[model samples]
Target: MLYIGLYLVAAGVGGIKGSLPTHGAEQFDESTPQGRIKRSTFFNYFVVCLSAGGLIATTFVVWIEDNKGWKWGFLISTMAMLLSIPVFLLGSGFYRNKIPNGSPFTTISKVLLAAIINSCSGKTTSNAVVNMATSPPSVSTQKSSDTKSKKGQEKTSENESLETQTQSFKFLNRAVNNTPVYTALKCTTKQVEEVKVVLKLFPIFASTIILNCCLAQLSTFSVQQAASMDTNLGSLKIPAASLPVFPIVIIMVVAPIYDHLIIPFAREITKRETGISHLQRIGTGLVLSVLAMAAAALVEVKRKNVAIKHDLVDSTKPLPITFFWIAIQYALLGSADLFTLAGMLEFFFTEAPSSMRSLATSLSWASLAIGYYLSSVIVSIVNEATSRGHHKGWLSGGNLNRYRLERFYWLLCVLGGVNFLNYLFWACRYKYRSTGSKK
Candidate 1:
């Protein structure tokens, strides 16, 4: 987990650092029609390919894990990362351009907005469900047949159905081929190129905050929770690390529902031409995070009280009769993920400049670094101070055995609240700039 976290930090920072304009002038605009079209194509290809690669790579890792130890798996992953460097650096030269001197906050704003959009897309599922529930029912009764020959009428209906199918396929192809990033990539100007790079990197960099917070919890507090509780699934006793599996399983089930049933409904009812924006989805994730922490806090409170009753000894194992805390953590985290992760993918791919889409994905992973640092700082201060005297407060000595983790989790709830509020303030103020727009 630590290695993965470090890797995320490295890649995310590199992406952010690399996206800066290397030259100082704007070179292209929507008026440059041919140039914009090519650039857009490049962007589309970059996003689709990069996303596919990551998906493939992750699947391979999972596959190898069952047959081989982590050492071999890491070795292969490291090799893949090393192999990709040359290509990224080669692409970087094409992407580099200069930025005008202005507020550093512009860069910050860009990152924040990118993050917000990604989050909005992430909430596609919830939005879909809401829309589905409210939509008017469809009337499917067939009209009485006209007096023409039944065979002729049947042939006409079949032709109509075939034409509809053909149109649907064509529409899907157009959607894939006509993205802005793809259009931008074929362009020659530096300005258009720079814009493309920004779109590519923004989603990844922005996502790091939430991702780090989430992924880190899987190995740490989550593990501790399992260890302190009775983890029996039927007759099988599970390991602490296995706790993450529950959330992963939930994700698998929920993902299909969101993609097939929710997103399309949301796009239709919200009157949002592109469905909910990424930022809105991320905001929903932040809200779910608050609930997840609250659940953890409740569990901690229960554990703490139990410890006090059992005399707080390391050897005196106070078994929690129920493993409902585990369920809460899994459910809350799972729901949060449905919004944030998917949105981040779409957000980074759409916003990133044409040449550096992979870097954008890396940036999303990097948010874990920031969240980890924050979690670490909070834990250190609380634990160190508590250990100084006889009292552990929330984290000291054996208090956690008493389920004091609840307090720490509550603190996270507070942090999530603040994060969400700040996010909302920024999102409302942001003005989106479409790539190649005249103004």
Candidate 2:
């Protein structure tokens, strides 16, 4: 029953969270400069609001769970979720509903199939050449050929008039080629371009996963690390789970400063809206994530040394080291999240095809999900390998004091450094589809 309830809740939450960002974005018109800026601002504030909610959870909800009960905490969360529905519906009349025309996947599949067939067949047949040179003359046949030739030329001109196929991925352009066979296949230029946009984003999306894997440490090992530390605050004992409040508070403070102060200053200097480009914002987050892991590793080393000095190696009691050290890494992680998550939301929303905005924005959430899964896999592998011969595993037991967490943090720091380099490679090469005009 517990498993069943968990699965159901996961499915429900996933559906709601996936659609919410796109729904909020659709409220703003993207055709105008004002609308685009508003949309970008919305994404930033959306993250700010999310962090605010997280702050409440880490503090109030955690306190309730610790003092009152878990049931009371769950009840409060359910009430909030229920209340948000009515609040959302109140704005329904103002929202511009973008109706689905048809499944974009069908068009994408057709383009893929047509491209494959065109490549396999080799050399496109020229319809204009066929029509112009094909006959023993009749006045009627001559006139028909002339009309067909004009139509083919007009079609070619139309394609040339719009944005040319990007130099990269020239192969997909076969789907939109003017060849007789490709024309019969009926792939539109817009559809081909949409596929290209997705292709370009793939590398950028994959590079962020390693950063998220580092982040997953916050929810798991970070909490455990805190659990084994002194969590006293002015004679009040704090829960280890509430340590996430550090990052949430950082985001709450940094987000507004970034939006109001940093963005306006950046806009004046760069002469572009949104202050910073989406990729630049994401890259900033990636770099900070590396620093956050490094910070975590250093703190862990200090904590471990203190624990060893006090002879708390096998003891379950909290070490005398201040929990403030953990807060340093948490603060960095939060600031990093503020940059990457908002940038990802805006980037995907702007760059995705109109029909696929929802799906594309969902990739931000999906990356975090993948990172958590990867973290689990890495932990398992690391444990198995390290727990051999005379060596005890880096993350072996319930007692974190016995665990070599500093080594694990250093590993993440190294992984984050490599991932940042990978992100820079893709980000430097990436061309924005919507914000292309912005310097």
Candidate 3:
């Protein structure tokens, strides 16, 4: 029953998550300079809200579950979710909803079919057929009604010439050529270009998966590592799960400093809007994640050495080392998350076609899902391989003190370093669709 309930909740979240970021982003116009800046700034604040929510959950919700009961903690969460509907409705009047244009998927399918047909026929589409495809339905109707109108004929000619000159994804552009066999399958130039934009973003999206795999450690091994260390702050003891609050706090402090001070300084030197490009921001996060994993490995090495030196490796008691050592990696990971997540949100929203913004922005969540899945697979493989030939796996034990967790952290650090290099390769070659005011 608990598993069923959890599955239902996951379904509900999956449905809502895709729409929310695009809906919030639609509030700002992308045409004006100020509007673009505001949209970028909104992405930063979105991360701040996420960090604040996590902070509350790790502290307040964990407290309720620990002292009161699990039922009460769940009840509070359900009430909060219920209250959000009314709060969202309150802003409906102010929203600028973009009306539906025909289905984008249908348009994409037409482009594909048209391309396949054109390829098989081995015949070039003629100028007349191309003109018909480029002209609007209304313009075609007017031409059929009054074939003798010189101005209408000239206007159609101009549009056809412009459509033929489109340079990107030239093969896809063939779908708009005016061929008798493809008259019913023709797509608009804008529709073909939208598909091109989505294709370009695919590689960039795939590159971030390994980085998320590194981040998966935060919720699992990082907490366990902290659990085995001294977590006392004077007379009070800290919860292991609540150790994530360190990163949340760091993000809260770093976001404002980066946005207000660091960005202004960067803008002055670079003379570009938004201070750093979206790709650059994402790259910065990738580097920090590498550093975070390295830091985790080093701290684990120190902790293990201390345990071995004092003959405490086999004991159940917490090690003499402070939990603050674990907090260092958590803090670094949090800062990396802030940079990468905000950059991804803005990049996908701005680069995707207006019609596909919601679908594109949702890729950020999908990457994290894939990352978590990859982490489990990697762990299974490592355990199976190591358990053979009388060697215990690095992560196979009930006791973390006995586990060689530092080796696992170092492996992630190496993977992260390779992923960063891959990200740089794509980010440098990729072109931005919108340059705001500077371009």
Better of 1 and 3 by TM-score: 3
- Top candidate, metric lDDT: 3
Could you give candidate 1's per-residue lDDT for residues 274-304 as a string of tens digits? 3456667767777888888888778767766
lDDT of 2 by residue, 6-34 (tens): 89889987887788889888887565667
Q: Where is model 2 more than 4 Å wrong at Cα? A: 62-72, 117-164, 176-186, 436-439
| Model 2 lDDT on a 0 to 1 scale | 0.81
Ranking by TM-score: 3, 2, 1
- Report backbone clashes per prediction: 51, 0, 2
Looking at candidate 1, what is the lDDT of residue 439? 18
Candidates in order have lDDT scores of 0.53, 0.81, 0.82
Query: Per-prediction RMSD in angstroms?
Result: 17.1, 7.3, 6.1
Model 3 regions lying over 4 Å from their true place:
102-186, 437-439
Q: Who wins the TM-score comparison?
A: 3
Question: What lDDT is reached at residue 61 by model 1?
Answer: 71
| CA lDDT, candidate 3, residue 56 | 89
Of 1 and 2, the candidate ahead on TM-score is 2
lDDT of 3 by residue, 1-439 (tens): 9999899999988877777788888898666667778888888888898888888888898899889999999998899989989999999899988898876677778877886787677755444534355646697776684765544554454345445545767787666655536578876665666777887888889888888888899989999888888999999998787887888999999999998899889889987788888888888989999999999999999999988988988887899999999988988888998899888888898787777788789899999899999999988887887786777898997988878789889999999998889888998899876645234
Per-candidate TM-scores read: 0.56, 0.85, 0.87
